[model samples]
Target: MSFNNANGGRQLTDLLIIGAGPYGISLAAHAKAHCLTYTLLGYPMHFWKHQMPQNMFIRTHPDSVYLSDPHESFTLLRFAAESGIDLPVPLPRPLFVDYATWFAARTGVRFTPEHVLQLSRTADGYEAVTEGGGVYTARHAVIATGLQHYSYIPDTYDGLPPGLVSHTFALTDFRPFAGKQVAVIGSGQSAWEAAALLHMAGSDAELIYRRDAANYREGQSGSELIQLGETFFDLPLEQKREKQVQPPGSAAAFLRPYVEGKIRETGNAVVQKAEAVDGGKLRLELSNGETRLFDHLVSASGYRIDIGRVPFLEQRLLELLEREDDGNGRYPKLDAHFMSSLPGLYIAGPLASYSHGPAFRFIAGVRKACRSIIPRIVRSMAHARSGSS
Candidate 1:
């Protein structure tokens, strides 16, 4: 049957996967190619919607970042090979966006491109509310927002002028800061890499964090399968409280060699350990009470799992979905199939690992997550068909 026949004028669908990042885009592309009658909605790469400078690169490796299609016709490696770019596979942000756009065009993956305002489940299916004033229905949903819905802004900096300070997530470009002085708060890969990029662009940059020194991720000597689950993904909620371990995503992923290269081994960038001082001027009072002047700042603080911020997450249903990040935060609890305890709902990406173990965060885990989820989705569709017949 033609896809339009299924779409028709009605908003009904077999499955509705939210947030069209790599994970969502991959899932949607696969479901449609399999003729599963699914509707994949949400903005396509909304994270890339903002303006970022052309000089940045992705932290992850290249060959692994991929879609779920079985054809294997297009891969990051192939894209790079065809472009003659010959960069490492993790892919730059812009190239990844171009890949997604190409996939959407080739596979007919659809997106609303507007904010999903609300989600609710009725007896028959789920209702998704969008800012464009449209309501769409589907029997199931897989959330693959891939960090677009969350930001790590600090509360103390809330009242500060937007120009004086901003989250690393908010940074769009570093070009204007050429020859300008800048202080970056946070020691994770983000803070480190942002500092490196700024310096390369000719900005005088300083790195600051609460810790005395940077704890770069220890490079895995072997495949991620050998790494600690805690290093790859957080332990389950019950498991964390029992061991009293620090929650996942609380610290940056273990630093790899490639990532460490971005740090200033030279004196061009300064690393200071301190909590930032509050002031009206652009000068920063260091933890040691030393003050330094800066033209701009970037806070690579951290993120919270507040359901209130996720535009597409259902309020009452989210209350029903148990927190799995060892109860330290409100993350969804999923079974081995990546199905949320909510039933008919599935989760992928970093969120799943806190419950299923460390595989949720890796490129390897993304492949594994889909391997388990897709079969179950197909089985679910088959069962529904038999029941209707």
Candidate 2:
């Protein structure tokens, strides 16, 4: 619950983890099992609690939505059974949040409920300053921050006034837009679902996307991509790329029927650009050469994993970190062990997807990430201690 330095100075640990979302909690479970001294900082499942809509359902199947526990006893399904909760496939968000909390408690991964304000390198390892003036020092730091901060608001609407436009990730509810003319941009699941929620809330909702139609995962029984088992990560880079051919943000097959029938009943219409208009409204320039206005606009365009947007990293340390082949801040260039160019610093979760491939993007991927990286980290720490002694 708390890891404060009683002496009002830096509390030293072997590992410091930021963000207690699914990835952070999974990594904390692994660190606990390894007997590594670590301090995890962040509210558990903060994004799910505050950002996602209250009635949302996860796209991942029940079987895949689990945090990695070395003992393998605690799982979403198991938690549901033990708690006498009936679980429907494509689990509900509330149930998953409860399951995550149960798993964190069951795994004994204590998290310090604080935000990391800044992270900088130190002579020994790294230093993290928290919101409450608490400083933590560790031999290494692992960033498990999820997609919350990376929400993508396209440049097309960048100059718009703040109240006129926003990302779907920023809104937890759509009730405020009731009776208002709202425009939901993008053809992805988020866009479709947001439109549906807006409609349910009594808003006049319209959808816009560049694509001719909304893309959804096809329901194919025993598909190779879905059946990717424990050894999937060991495949060649080309093989991984083959599986990642599916573009991001496409709706899951399980929700396709509902979304298509209820939300995007009509196919997508092209939107060339969007501009802010008077009275806190937005003007959409359609590819069909017509302009329309809406009282509010929500971009469900998805997130861009630009590392530069991460505000906590010190400038000097940020410059030292390597970037992906594109040499863009969109992704970090990580080594085989998921360590960045800077030694003893690791990147996990969706951020690791660029290097580790598609599997790193969701809760399903956390097990593989932890299984692969934890042992390496333990070994490196051991070696460091021996060398110093």
Candidate 3:
């Protein structure tokens, strides 16, 4: 079912995908392969290119980072072999971005480079309005925006003046903090890695965390869990939750030697309070009663997924959808096929993790998500067409 929109006459398609990251691009590729109409919108790999720190290495294995297509013709191994580049163990961010760009080109996945401002329910389906005033209508809409909009910062440091405090998501360069005292907060891989990067950039960087000690996953590879595919999803909820919450401070084992002497680690501590002081420095009061001064503070506190935080989703649409609370947070309730309570709407990527299991949080999960969702969408489109005829 296709129609020209009244607003600027944009063509309507069967599926409207709202993001252009791994999940969104993978879904579009599958839709195209299945002969389904889809309109994919967003800048390709925007978060990786702009948000992530330069020269950073991801914990996910190089073998697990490929964007999915129906034929699996564009895997990372294929890209590396064809391009004559050797694959690194812990993939570098820039190299993975290059592979994504190459995969999109190889699969012919073209996307609109526009920010979607609003998404609301239409009479026949869902409608999305882009920043450029373009309208997109489709029988089904998939939300695969990923973690870009969900950066989480603790409220304790809220009183610190602007420019004195920033989240890791907002920072890509550490050169600005060179020769300055910097405090990096959180216990995740991101936090530890950011501190290491800052130290390498010549900052007197200290890693602060509330955990007793940094927990490094020495021999474990996430690819093992990712390879489980649907088997992991079938685990009991308790088991799933246990796997979902990686120990705070858990980072790739290889990083331990690289970052050990470069950055100082202050465990079992958190910044209880912070205030701006003279010369634009921040005075932080630690929970352990130690007061310290730093030129800047970086919150590597990671992200909290909440559909309400997504600006593009209209309030009415948010209200109509059902949600699932996983003890730690609430997420959209999704069915086996990744469909939300709203019949024609679906959720994917990290947002679908609560219902589909934790694998959806990484690029490795894209194949499974697309595999489950695309067939359901194909059937829905066929049923809609038959009814209309």
Candidate 4:
């Protein structure tokens, strides 16, 4: 469908997808199959292409990397066969990005490469202002921006200068720190992997966490979790929370062997305090009654969902949407259809995990989210059209 008006005026579409990640791409593919006029905005796989370290590997299995579509025709397996690649268990980041790009092309999903700078409500629907001076109107809007935007740095590093500290999301290359001593904070997959990657690049890297010990597990096939599907959404909130919380200091079993003898690991230790020492170094006081200095710090501490951090959302819309009373108001309270309290606005991907279930946090959840969200959008549009007629 033609998105722009023939006279080159403001474009109008039935649906506006605000990201080009797995969630956004999946949603757009479903919408196209359903014959809905939609506009997708954002660079495809922006985070994976620019933010992630080039040598890093994803924790998800190859079976879980497929972007969802109505027919399920495009999958990582098919891509691997067509592209003549022997897919690995722990997929490399570059391969996954390539697969996503191929999926988009094969599915005929096209997107405008500009990001929405501001999204505000209009009388008929929603209006989005793009960074490239483009305006588009849609009867419905879905936000699928992934986790990179929500990278979380703990308050403990507040005193350190920005030059000396960075979240893993911000550091794409480790060669600069080749001869320097670096400390990676957190015990999760990202933390451990960052430390290992830094050490591999000649940095004297150390992994530090507040847990008693690192929790390493065998490679996950993700079939069981994928089977859970909607059943996870049926559980009680407290139960869902229990299943969602990953063990402190958790890393994939394969990572242990790679990082073992190469990186120093300290457990049951928290950065109680930090200060900038002379010669551009950081002095950190640990909870275990130890003091140390490092040339740099990487807060692999991971992301926390806070809708307020989404810069494109306008103030009025932000205040109007209902948020879950989960103490921190980190997630939007969504219904069974993934629609937010504000009508015609939907949220997916990790941002929807709190309300839908923890499964939404992974790429495996993309199909489930598309199945729920696309049909709801179609039904809502039909209802609106009949009423207008």
Candidate 5:
């Protein structure tokens, strides 16, 4: 399938995946194995290379980091053995990105390397507008954009100007904040990590959280067998709810030694709220009512899952899909096969986690998602042909 010139001037496919992240790539690989025509768009590992800090590491264990394939030949362990690289537990970011690129090449999964500017529903299926002035139509579409669009800044800092406030997701480097007084909000991994990075980069950084004190994840006693089903990825919806006890922003994984030491040395800080004051600085009201000014504030407050944040999703298409909100935010209702209210459209990755369970938020979730969705896609294709005839 030549995606570039498939139908002359424009491309078309049986399945259109809008992201090339872990989930997106995995889905495309499955579609190919099923002998289904599919087209993948977007830069592979774009966030891992650009949005994340250079020195950052994935919280997931090396054994757990993977994209699902039919033969299972591209496992991290297999990749390490083939490449002769020592794969550690907390895998380095650069190494993982390399593995992803290598996997895509080995699988022979062709990608368009274009951004999907907008998406809308069509009579037969859907239409996607690309940044390169290309139009693609597909009988089915899956959204795998990941958490890039879901980064949330608190409502308290709503009135603050852009430069004075930002989120950790937007910070690729800390050198720009050198010699400036920066206040980091939240006590989770991103918050503490950002504070440490800022301080190490020559900024006077401090972490402030609503909790009494920071809580670090306790170390495990011993290594356990790494199994997909046991990892909570294959659990039923009710069981998944029981297992996921931590709050949304809480990081169950511990920080690296160097970053932890830096945060501890800075001492504990708590905040009640923040307000904009003179000189374009933020005046933070502490729990004890003491106020302080800072050059900038970074909200590591974490992501709020809202379906509407996806800018490219046309409003009409969005409204047509059935959604359920649990007071926090709205998420599309998905079936057992991860198909949305729209018969042919599917939702994967973090966005579908709410309906399917927390397992959809991790790489472990990709296996089940692909296994379930691909077979259903084949069935749908067969049904469509039979109906048209």
Candidate 6:
């Protein structure tokens, strides 16, 4: 999908999607069903790019987590039909990825393997450039790049240099840290997985958290937040008008007490709570005032919505991506459908998680995600077509 050089009013494609994960695939299938002109460009299931280690099970039930189709054709159950693996049950990670590849091939979805450097609006719509010598344009663009790209690596470790510190997402194994002291920050799965791999690889590790143990639970905290919002935050007037847009409650909940708990359970790991990283060290400046140093620090702190960090967003659009509050660094204010303040721009997956409710990060969210935005795209398409190109 190359740029349309001619003067533009209503650009080329009716829709163009970036980051071809499950979110992008679902949208492509939706577009096809609606007979809309759209193109999906990116590595399909790119989130799986960082290969999961040797023996980790999929956190979700395979029956519930589907890739492209709404039902029947591309279901994981169908893939299991051949392998003799049980359907409606969780399958191994390797099998899940293989199913996604098979689904993509069968559906004729174009999965371009490229790293997008930036996304900016052209007169025609949006133009995306790659690190390689490739550029493309679309009338409307959707960002579904999953949650792995951006991370919440604290600046405290920025000056440490190289092997001494890293984000949890960047590491695959902890064998190199064997016999070395390493600190794993955050209470999520990424943090847990890092610590587990470290222990398996024979590293001395401690998993630290900023929250109390009471806050941890099985299932998501969103259920509690949603109920609490009804009494405090969600006003009758707002509920009457459907003001229940997403605003961050529980992310990474399914991983339990989270990935951190599992790692902490490992014999080689210690649980350090109410502490945060101060400079290059873990400073326990809470109910327990202790300080310790480690040879390496891994931040599994997750991500924050910083429009400024987004490569594709232009400066003007960046301003629009910020929430109304005094720049705590959120995203462009969006509709329930994940449509940005800018016209003809939509977002899916992690970037729109705050506005799309707790399920935005999972495959289970696909049906609702596609439903919310497709109608808007269809209506907008009529108007877009009447204009120019």
Q: What are the lDDT figures for the candidates, one per model?
A: 0.62, 0.78, 0.83, 0.85, 0.77, 0.61
Query: Which parts of model 6 are misplaced by more than 4 Å?
Result: 1-11, 51-54, 68-73, 87-91, 155-158, 210-287, 291-293, 320-329, 383-389
Error of 6 at 375 (Å): 3.4
TM-score winner between candidates 2 and 6: 2
- lDDT by residue for model 4 over 1-389, one digit each (tens)? 11222222366688989988889989999998999988888888887799888787887788766889998999999999999989987888899999888888888887877788999999878888887788888889999888867888888788678899989885888899999999998888889888888988899998889888888987777776666656677888778778777555578988887798888889999999988999999998999999999999999888887899999999999999999878888789998888999999999988888887667777767988899999998998889889999
Question: Listing every candidate in turn, what is its Cα RMSD in Å to the true structure after a full C-alpha superposition?
Answer: 5.4, 2.7, 3.0, 2.2, 3.3, 6.3
TM-score of each: 0.77, 0.91, 0.93, 0.95, 0.89, 0.75
lDDT tens string, model 3, 254-347?
Answer: 7887679778889899788889999888998999999899999999888888888999999999888888876544698888888999988999
Pairs in steric clash, model 6: 10-388, 119-312, 192-259, 321-331, 321-332
TM-score of predicted model 2? 0.91
The per-prediction tally of clashing pairs is 8, 0, 1, 0, 0, 5
Question: Which of candidates 1 and 6 is the stronger one according to TM-score?
Answer: 1
Query: Which 10-residue window of candidate 1 scores lowest in summed lDDT?
Result: 1-10
Task: Please report how far candidate 6 places residue 378 from its true position, in Å.
Answer: 2.6
Per lDDT, the best of the predicted structures is: 4
- Candidate 4, pairs of clashing residues: none
Clash pairs, model 2 backbone: none
lDDT of 6 by residue, 1-389 (tens): 12223222333667878877778877877776777776576766766645455444455655466765544477777777866766532245666777777776666565556667777888878876665545767777887767665667665554455656777664766678888888776655566666667877888787766544412334332333323322322245455235334342232344443244434432222334323355544432223455566777777766765555666666766765546242465655567666887777887775654555445655656666677677788888787668855
Count of clashes in candidate 3: 1
| Model 1 misplacement above 4 A | 1-9, 49-54, 71-73, 81-90, 105-108, 155-158, 176-179, 200-202, 210-280, 358-364
Q: How far out, in Å, is residue 199 in model 3?
A: 1.4
Q: What is the lDDT of candidate 4?
A: 0.85
